[model samples]
Target: MKAADFASASPSAIRAMIGRGEWTGPTPGMAKGHVQANLVILPRDWAYDFLVFAQRNPKPCPILDITEPGDSEPSIVAPGADLRIDLPRYRIWRDGELVEEPTEITSHWRDDLVGFLLGCSFSFEGALLEASVPVRHIECGCNVPMYRTDIACRPAGRLSGPMVVSMRPIPASLVTRAVLATGRFPAVHGAPVHIGDPALIGIEDIARPDFGDAVPINEGDVPVFWACGVTPQAALMASRPPFAITHAPGHMFICDPKDSDYAVF
Candidate 1:
């Protein structure tokens, strides 16, 4: 389905398509006003440290909903949704290395596994659009550019790494407005973490991101970065727990919660 088609699709419908393997792509523009989430699954033994990591670093890993050990159903976000088959794509990690990217992970599900659903910036893109702030990646029909930064996350047991950020080139004139618009949704990765020089954040080249696609920056645009949900995946890679699972970058879990449910103001 095209981006426009997904703009009006229901969260349940989107999940169904993903379950059926009919749609396997980035979910930015899908289920427009709903909350979309980043997925992280780890063995029960490793979940505590990750939970502490998310609590300490809420901006990069806002905990939306967490499943009971061995349960794939995300009861809080989407009660009937089966996380293992509901997202378009998933990444499997073994010993800190990405071993596979698959359309579904039912075969990899384990009884000792715990699933985490973290807030995604995609939840606030609607607000940005409503306020007339341009979301460049949606406009360009591409994935938002993401970079690994020099900022260090507080360590929790074995989970620790530099933060990752997603960038959108905003018109210089609307930078503050963009910040205000997104800041209202703290549950999502809200507001700009960095507003200017990419190099200051250890992003050497704006054209080459550590993750996602690169979009063009217009002459009057300024790069605005937000703490990304992908940050935990970076930590997973750095710490290399024996096994883990996460959403493929851009391919997120569409939740039934309205974006307004997460808005603070």
Candidate 2:
């Protein structure tokens, strides 16, 4: 379905599609206006470290919802829903390596696992689009380009790594307006960290991203970067824990909370 379709779709409708295995791709435009989340399922043994990691890296890892050990249902975000089967797709990791992409993880479920729901950039992108600030990636139908930055996140147990940022080249004039619009929603990977000069952030090739597809960079557009929720996934892969699970790239957990629920003055 198109992104416009999601603008009016209820959170439950979106989840139903995912639950039925009808849609298993990225959730960019799905369930619009509702808050979408990043999934991070880990063993109870690693939960404390990951939680501390999220605490230290709030910008990229804002906590929207979290579930207790062995709990498959996210009571706070989606009541009467099972996280393992509610999302369209999931990535399983063993020893930090991506080993499988499964539609459901009923067999993989372990009794000592905890789940975390992180705020995604989709929330802020919705805010930008509403305010008439253009998001080039969406307009071009390409994946929002992301990169690994030289910027380091504060260390927390086994989750320390460089910050990863997603880029959306905005027209020079709309930069400030875009920042102000997104700043109001700090719960979901808020306003940008850098406004121009990719080199300044140690990104040498803006066209070749470390993650996601590259979108066009118009003549008058300036690259704007925001802390990405995927930073933790990258760290988890690097750290090579015994087991971990996360939403596949753009695939996310659609939440019951509306985008306005996170607006701050």
Candidate 2 Cα errors over 4 Å, as ranges = 1-7
lDDT agreement with native, every candidate = 0.90, 0.89
lDDT of 1: 0.90
Scored by lDDT, model 2 comes in at 0.89
Model 1: lowest-lDDT 10 consecutive positions? 1-10
Clashes of each: 1, 0
Q: How close is candidate 2 to the true structure, as a TM-score?
A: 0.95
Q: For each candidate, what TM-score against the reference?
A: 0.93, 0.95
State how far residue 181 of model 1 sits from its true place (Å).
Answer: 0.3
Q: Model 2, poorest ten-residue lDDT window?
A: 1-10
Tell me the tens digit of each residue's lDDT in model 2 across 22-61: 8877777777778889999999989888889988888998
Clashing pairs in 1: 96-240
